[model samples]
Target: MQRLLVALLAAFDAAIAAAVGLVVLLAPLTLLWTLAFGITADWGALWPLTGTLWEFGHGVPLAVTIPDELLVALAIPAQAASFAVSITPLAFLLFTLLFAARSGARAAAAGTWLLGVLSGTVVFTAISTAVALTARLDAAQTPLLLAIVLPAAVYFVGALCGAVRVAWEEGDGGILDRLHDRLDVHEDWAPVPAAVVRGAAFALVGVVGTAALALAVMTLFRGGEVVALFQASRVDALGATVMTLAQLVYLPTLIVWAASWLAGPGFAVGVGTAVSPAGTQLGVVPGVPVFGLLPENSSMWMLIVVLVPIAAGAFAGWAVRSRLVWEGTPLGTAQRAVIAVGIAVVTAGVGGIAAVLANGSMGPGRLSEVGPAALPFMLALGLEVLVGAAILLLSPRHRDELAEERTDRWIAEMSELEPSQAPVVPVPGIPLPRAHDQAFDDTAPLDDVRGFRPPTGNRD
Candidate 1:
C-alpha cells in the first residue's frame, strides 16, 4: 500500500511538472506574436520581461505589457505574494483529491478531479483573457498563451488529484471510515440530513469567503493611480490584474466547494450557488419578469432563479433524509444532475442579464469587448455545483458501507478472543497443574479436598 501510494504521488508530481513545462514552452510563441503585431507599440521591450516572468512563474506572473508603446509596472512582489496565497488552495485540493482517491473515496475523488480540472481551465482562461485584453499585447499572443497554459494547468492539476487519490485509498484508516465516525448518529441511524446541512454550510462559507477575498484583492490592487499608470503607459495592467484576481479567487472556491460536497450535499449546493452568483446572473439572461408585470433588474432575476434551485435542492435533501440509509445514497444521480443543471442555468441567466443591464446602465460601449472567457468559468462553476450536490447526496451510502466495514472488523477482532487465553495466576515457587491432570487425580477423594492445603504447609 505504501509503495502504491508513493507511485501515485510520483505520477501526480510528474504530471504537474509536465504541465508547468508545457506552459513555459508556450511563452516564447506568445512573445513572438506580441513582437510581430505591435499591440503595445511603445511597450514592446516589456514583453521580454513579461515572457521571462511567465516562464519562471509557470505562466503565473503579474506584469502588463502594451502592444509596442509603453509599460507600467505594478508591485510585482505583492502580486506574486497574492498569487502564491491563492495557489495554496489548488495545492490543498490536489493533495486532498489524491488522498481521497487512494483512500477509496470514489465520490469524493470524482468530485475533486472535476474541480481540479475546472480550476485549471479557469486559470488558463484568466491568463489568456489578460493577454487578449492588453491593447499593446499581440493578438497572436492570446492563442499562444492559451495553448500553453491550459494544458499545463490541466495536467498539473490532474496529476496532483490522481496522486492524492491513490495515497488516500491505500493509506491506513480510509477517509470513509473517518467520515463514518463523524457522521454516525446511532448504531442503526444514518446522519444524512446532518451531513448535508454541514456540507452545505461549509460550501456556503467557503464561497462567500472566496468572493469577499476577490473583492478585497481587487480593492487593494486596483487603484485609480495604478490604472492610470498602466493607461498612461499604454499597458493593460488593470485588465490583467482583474483577470488574475478573478482566477485567484475562483480557484480556491472550487476546491472548498468540492471538499464540502464530499462531506454533505446541502453544503455543496449552498457553496455552489453562493460562489456562482455571477454565473447564475448570466444564465437569467434577458431577465425574468417579476409579477408578470414589472421588469426587475437582471441581477435581481438571476438572484431569484439561483435561490429557487438551492431551496429546491435543500428541500429535496431534507425530504429524503429519513429514506437514506447509506452515505452516497440520499439522492439519485438523475436528481442531483437536475439540480446541478438547474442551478447553472439560473446562475448563468442571471449573471448575463446583470452584466448586460450593468453595461447598459453605465452607458453604451462603456465596457470594452472581451473574449467569452467568463462563460467557461461560469459553466465550470455550474458543473461543480451539480457534481458537488451529487456527491453529497450519495455520501450516506458510502458512510453506511464504511460503518458496516468497521463493525465487521470489530467483530472479527473480538472473535479472536478465547476464554482459554485468559491470563494465568502464578503461584510463587510452585508449578501449575494441568486441569486434566487435576481431574484425573480425583482418586485422592473429594472428601479429603474439603480441607484446603496451605501454601507453606502451615495450619491457619
Candidate 2:
C-alpha cells in the first residue's frame, strides 16, 4: 500500500512540474495578449500560440511561414518573410528540468528510487505528448518527433541525476553503493581519478568566472549602445520585459561564447564573421542589445586574451598539486601527468559542446551562423590547459615533500600494528644490599648492569 502511494505521489508531482512550467510561460503571455488586443483577440488562436511557444522552449525546431499576401502588402522582401526559428531561450526548459529533478529526488527519498524515477518520467512524457498533440499553430508546426522526444529526454536525464544523487547520499541496496564499495576496495587506483575530476571542475569554474568578469566589464563600456538598441526595438514594456527575461536565461550561453573568444576561436554573429581578440570580421549583425558588446575592429594586442585558458589550466594544476600534498598517496609523476592531461581533455570536450550550443542562428542569412567553431575552440582550449597542467604535473617534487610523505606513511603503518609487537620492560634482577650491609663495606658491591642505578654527583 505504501509503495502504491509513493508511485501515485511521484506521478502527481511530475504532472505538477509540467503544469508549473507551462502555466508560468503561458499565463503572462495570455494576459498580455488580452490587454493588447482586448476582446477582439482570437482567444482560441492565442492558446495554441502559447502552446507552440512552450513547445519551442523545449528545443523543438519551429518553421514560421508568413502569409504571401501579408508579405507583399507590407512591402517586405519575399525571402525575409519566412525564416526558420530554431534558436531557443532555455529558461523554461531549465525550470522544467530542475522541477522534474526535485520531484525525482523527493520520490527517491520516499523509499523506492527506481519506481519514483520511472513513474515520474512516464507521467511527464505522457503530459508532454498530450501538450504536443493539442497545441499546433497555423503559422508554426514543430517536428512530431521533437515534440515527443525532447521533453522526454529532459525529464529522463533529470530523473536519472536525481536518482543518482539520492543513491549516493543514502543507498538503497543499489548499484551506486555497490560501485562505490568496489572503488573503495581499489583505494590505490582512486586518488588520481578523483583528483582529475576535482581539477577539471576547478578549471571549468575558472573559465566561467573569467568570462563573467569580462562580460561585466564589457557591459560597463557598452551600456550606451545596448540601451540604444533596446530603444530602437520599440517593444512595449511587457514585451521588452519578456525579452529581457529570455536574454537572462541565455546569459550562461553567452558566457561560454565569451570563453571561446578568450580561447581565440571567437564567436560569430553571422556567416563569414569572427569576433575574436585577434580581429573583428563582422559584415552585418542583428540589433539585439546583447550584440552591442561585440568588439569593433580593435587592436592586435587583444590577442593576448588567449592566455586565459592557459591560466585557468595552471590554476587547476596547482589546485591538484596542493591536494596531492595532503593526499599522502604514492602516485608516480607519470600518473600525475596522465591525470592532469585527462582533466584538460575533458574540459576541452565541454568547451566543444558549449561552442555548439552557444553558436546557432538567431535569424536568417548572415545571422544564421553564430558562436565559435567547436573544433578550433576545443583544440585551442585543450592544448592551452595542458600546457598549464604539464607545468605543475611534470615538475620535480622537493625532498622535503618526499620526507614528509615518508613520515606520514610511517605513522599510518604504526597505527595499524598490533600491541603485542611492542618491546617489553624487564623486571629488576638484583635483590641487592640493605642499608646496613652497604654501610659495612668500604666500597659498595657493583650493581648488576641490568639493574637501575642512582646518579653520582662526582665526575672524574
Candidate 3:
C-alpha cells in the first residue's frame, strides 16, 4: 500500500512538473509571436489549426482561445524542433536529473517541483496574454492558429531542455560529484513526509492569519472614532509628542504583526498563538480573552493590538531557537530579530504615511489633490532608507547552515568516511577553492570550464 501510494504521488508530481515546463517554454514564444504578427488574427481559422496541432503533436485536444492560438503558434514550433533534436521524453526530466546529480533525491524532488511551477506560470501567462492581445483580431484565424501550434511547441521545448540537461550532467564528472556532495548530508532525514506536513500546515495557518487580519483592519476603519481623534488633536508641542508616541507604539505593533503574518508559519505561527486581545468574547485565538476591551467599532485596533505582541513573541522565540518551526536549517538570533523588525517597521511607516496623505486635508484643494498619491511614493522611499539603516546598525549574522551541510558532505567524500563516523580529513586529489574564488564570476563561460580537467595530484 505504501509503495503504491508513493508511486502515485510521484506520478502526480511528474505530470504537474511536465505541464509546468511546457508552459515556461511556451510563454516567451507566444509573447514574441504576438509582438511580431500583431493581435488581429482570424480566430475561426486559428481554432481548427490549434485543435489539429494538439491532436497531432501532444496527443491531447486542449481547448484554447484565438489570441492564445497566435501565441501558441510562435512558441510551439521552436519547442518541438528542440525536443526533436534532443529526443528527451519530458520537460521536467532535466530539472529532476540536475537536482539528483547536485543534491541527491531530496534536492532533485524540490528542484523538479520548482521548475514545474515556473513552467506552469509561464504557460498560463502566455495563453492569457495572447487572448488579451488578439481580442480584436479575426476570430476564425485565431482559433485555428492556436489549436495547431501551441501544444507541439511546448512539448518539444520541454523535451529538448530535459535531454540536454541529462546529457550534460552525465558527461561532466566534476558537476556530478558536486551534486552528490551537496545532497549527502540530509540522507538520514525523510524529505517527502516532512515536506508534505509542513506545506499543508503552513497553508492552513496562512489562510487563517490573512482572514483575521483583513477582518480586524476593515472593522477599525469603519468605526470612525480614531479619525475623529486625529482631527481633534491640538497644535501644541505636548500634543505633537503624544501623537508621535501613539503613532510609534500603535503603528509599530500593527506593522510587526502584519509582517509576521506575511512571513507565514515560520515567523507568524508562534506570534499568532501568543497574542491575546484584552477582556472576553472575541479573542484572536479560540478560547482566549482579548477581544472584549476593543471598542465595538474598533476592529482595526483590535487586530493591531493582537498582532503586535504576537510578532514580538514570535521574533523572540525564533531568535532563541535559531529555527522557525517549518525550516530545516537554523538562523542566528540576530538575523531573526532583524528580519522581523525590519519588515514590520518598513511596512507600517509606508502604509501609515500613504493613508494620511491620501485622506488628509491640506489647505485649498491645490496641494491636497495632487500631493496625496505622491505621499505614498515618498513614504515608501523613506521607509526603505529606514529599514536599510536598521539593518546596518543591527549587524545581523546570517548563519550558512545549508552551506555547512554541503561542506561536510564534501569533506566526507574526500576522506572516505563512513556515514556514521565524524568527517575525516580532506582527500588529496580534490581541489577545494577558497571562498573568494568560489564566488560567482559572470564573465567566465561555464561551457569552457566544463571541458577543463583539474590536476589529479594529492594535496595532502
Can you write out model 2's per-residue Cα lDDT over 1-460, one digit (the tens) per residue? 8778878988998888888878876887777887888988888887677778777777777887778888889887778766776665566666777887887787778768888888888998898888888888867888877888888778877777777677666876777678778877977655766677778878898888999899989999998998998999999887788778778877877788889988888888888888888789878678888888888886789989878888888899888877888777757876788877888998998888667656666666676787778899999999988888888777888798889898998888867865544333433554444445543433334464466578899999
lDDT of 1 by residue, 1-460 (tens): 6444444544443345434433443564455546655575545545544433333223232223233222225433332221111112233233323433332232234434333433434444454345434423332232355435643454445444453444344432455456556555543333433343334443344444444454445446545544444454443545454434434433543333322222222111111122232232111121111101111222433333333334433433333443343343434555444444454454444333222211111001211221122344345444444454554454455666558667766766767865444335654444454775643432343334545554696677
Q: What TM-score, computed on C-alpha atoms, does each candidate reach?
A: 0.29, 0.82, 0.25
RMSD of each: 19.9, 7.4, 24.9
Question: Would you list the C-alpha lDDT of every candidate in the order shown?
Answer: 0.38, 0.79, 0.35
lDDT of 2: 0.79
lDDT of 3 at 244: 49
- The most accurate candidate by lDDT is 2
lDDT of 3 by residue, 413-447 (tens): 85785333433344344344444544342134434
Candidate 1 lDDT for residue 143: 38
What is candidate 1's TM-score against the reference?
0.29
